[model samples]
Target: MKSPKASSVTIALILLLITGWLLWSSAAAAEETPYIRGAALIDTHGCLACHSGNLMGAMKVPPLRGCELPEEEFQAWVLYGCPQAQPGRAQQSRFGMPAYEGHLDPEDVQDILAWSQIAGHEVPDQAALSDLARGEQVALKAGCFDCHGPLGQGGIKNTGSFTGAIPGFSGEQFKHLCDDGDPAAIEEWIRHGTSERFLSGEPLAGLGRSFMSSQLTKMPAYQDILSDEEIELLVRYCLHINSLGPMSAERYEAHRAALASSKMEVTGQEDSLAGPSLPREVAELFSSKCIRCHGPKKQKSDYRMDTAAAAFQSGDIADFLEVSVIQPGAPRESLLYQFVSATEEDSLNEVFPMPPSEDERLSPEELKVIRDWIASGAPWSDKQTLQSAYSD
Candidate 1:
């Protein structure tokens, strides 16, 4: 899968590992200041992609920050794609609020709303050591892992891509996506979802789009999804993770576990990073409750949380859907818990809570079992689940 220019890519990765990438403690990161995750979400989802990055309206998309409507009315329009304009405005425009109804949970309405009230806030201009954590969340929330491979290590197959796979966040392969670690280049891909220069420039001589057309899985445009600040954080994250060199998928997960353990040490959360162990008490609970759908016996949608390794291996329906099935210590962050915890009306994109039926839904005690399990590091007993049962 390597390009002929492998040597050049290797040299670049070595340089990055030696001097460019620095993983520092959270305190060191705070020195760079922080932007709200809301703002970060704004960027990754490309909220400002069409309109001017300055929050000034462009083409026909209205200015995101200067609506004169009452707060309640504006908030309503935001949650329900801002299709309603007043006496002076046209009903149809090239771009308005992207549909948030089924895509982003209702809770996100507030974070996005809070960002709208602020002027010119973006993910910090300078990189934050703290970006490590938030960037991962951004990537996960944006579904980078689904296309790039788990944790952005980049091994997912792409039928017609040059390397025949999506590139990892880091490594020589990323040069196709970003040139010489240039921030603008990375930002171009993030905000526009494709680099105009790369597609039409001397390098590919206009074949970039052609090649992309034949690919089975392609990068989605974030113009409507992410905002500018979110793009920068993800860009920094890609550069930093690239310092790890090209790792096989197994090595990547081992590295991830090590990182998780280190995170626990830094935060002093004893159970935040899970290990491969499940209390015997809860093992049967999964067997009785979850396995009917997500167990080894009959994996629904190719997902089974039956094994510890399987739990972390992953799940995702789409962007804004919970990318991490079990986010270790964050029960609410985990899609598994989110699904089981939802009420009937909380359905996303028509996706209902677990059991998909009123009769079989977990009891409150049963709900607490998984929720507390997730909060307590979501320990599971097993190892080495494949990314999927049928495919590599």
Candidate 2:
């Protein structure tokens, strides 16, 4: 009813407002899409708990700060755990990823995928070729960091019924193992895997084959898993770390001296009716079963049971031992006892039982030793012996 110019202006203004609203709505949706959905999915599924450095038994959970994986592979891993995608691949930690097959909906999987891609993309790609940097990248991609730590500083990896302390690459022992300047021996060891004990002239002993074969997680054969180039990179990385000087050189030397001075003394006679004193027996038990993860090189959960002082003073270890790990005069209430006694079925819905893997669980006799040790006040008398043994 108004003039044509006035009507046209009103129509144009309406169109402009509508267009602005649509554009703003689209932008808002785009901004919120990936991160919002992905973060929610990750949180709800408890992915952060494992990936963000929570201890699952003795294993040090690799930080997921810079995780990168193919979309389909990531999805499969999240939904089915490790066995489905890589059948014989060693589990990442004592408590490996739980299969979210029935738990996560299809949309939930998609959201998780979106989150992984977004989070991964946020981290800059490693492009440096320096020995240290390149070596780290190689180790990270090869899953060495899962057991060896992000900096190759060493950690623990379950090997059969016991745990093995992975030596830090930057240590004198590791340097000696690598044959100083030559990395060929290390390369060969990687290529052939653990089957052949010696590589070139270097002895590649220590990892017990019988024990390895009996466990669900074993050192993987790089010949099958990694390319020649990858192995070479790892060797180079090890060499570079060795060149950087040993971690705590002074401490290492002092420890070496102590070991040299200490005389080999038997704890108890072979046929002694009374088992070794609680301290000696517990020391042996810890050395054989616990030190790998809680020793000097790797202190998963900041708990170190290798030495008396470390066990009693490192982080909350003392409290945990007193309360959860060892309850004086009450083995049944002890979390350590409970964990060791847990069956495969008990761990299905939650984290896997202590030692985590079925094959690595303590034997009935071993369990009894632990129970008796706890019931007897968990005394720690032979501190000097443990300190001397674990000096390295």
How does each model score on lDDT?
A: 0.57, 0.54
Q: Which segments of candidate 2 are over 4 A away from where they belong?
A: 1-124, 159-163, 172-182, 195-216, 245-392
Runs of candidate 1 with Cα error greater than 4 angstroms are 1-129, 248-392
For model 1, residues 1-392, the per-residue Cα lDDT tens digits are 87869988998899878663343122122110011334456677777676465545344566665344555565456555554533324233234554454445434654555445423223222233344556666887898877775455455667766556677665654765577667787778887777776666546455567766777776788867887777776886676566443432223332343334333333534453454456554565666556767765677767777667666666545224647777655566567777777788878454458777777688888887776666545655454232223321
Put down candidate 2 lDDT per residue, 278-339, tens digits, no spaces.
54556676776666666767876676666555554534533534555554445565565676
Worst 10 residues of 1 by lDDT: 26-35
RMSD of each: 18.0, 25.7
TM-score of every prediction relative to native: 0.32, 0.29
| lDDT for position 5 in model 2 | 100
Name the best candidate (by lDDT). Answer: 1
